[model samples]
Target: MSRERKREGALYLCNQRQRGEEGKASGKEDEREGETRTD
Candidate 1:
């Protein structure tokens, strides 16, 4: 369940970044892993 755990972690980070207006980095990180956290 490593991937699932990573996804959850990424989502948490992404939300934090979105709040700080730095979501671009988070989105790129997710995209590189074939996932996305679009707003």
Candidate 2:
């Protein structure tokens, strides 16, 4: 509702999104490793 609160909320959302992206990247790396093992 307040401007400061809005800024904090945005920061929190951005941090959460960054974490999700990192998780996805790590998962992809693991899949690549599995493929390499198969090859």
TM-score to true structure, per model: 0.46, 0.61
* Residue range 1-39, candidate 2, lDDT tens digits: 699999999999999999878878777876788899999
Q: List ranges where model 1 is wrong by over 4 Å.
A: 22-39
RMSD of each: 10.2, 7.4
The best candidate by lDDT is 2
Evaluate model 2: give its lDDT: 0.89
Model 1 / residue 7 / CA error / Å: 0.5
RMSD score of candidate 2 (Å):
7.4
In model 2, residue pairs whose N, Cα or C atoms come closer than 3 Å (at least 3 residues apart or on different chains), thus clashing, are none
Model 1 Cα displacement at 18 (Å)?
A: 0.6
RMSD of candidate 1 to true structure, Å: 10.2
Ten contiguous residues minimizing lDDT sum, candidate 1: 30-39
Per-model CA lDDT versus the true structure: 0.73, 0.89
* Model number with the top TM-score: 2
Q: Any idea what lDDT model 1 has? A: 0.73
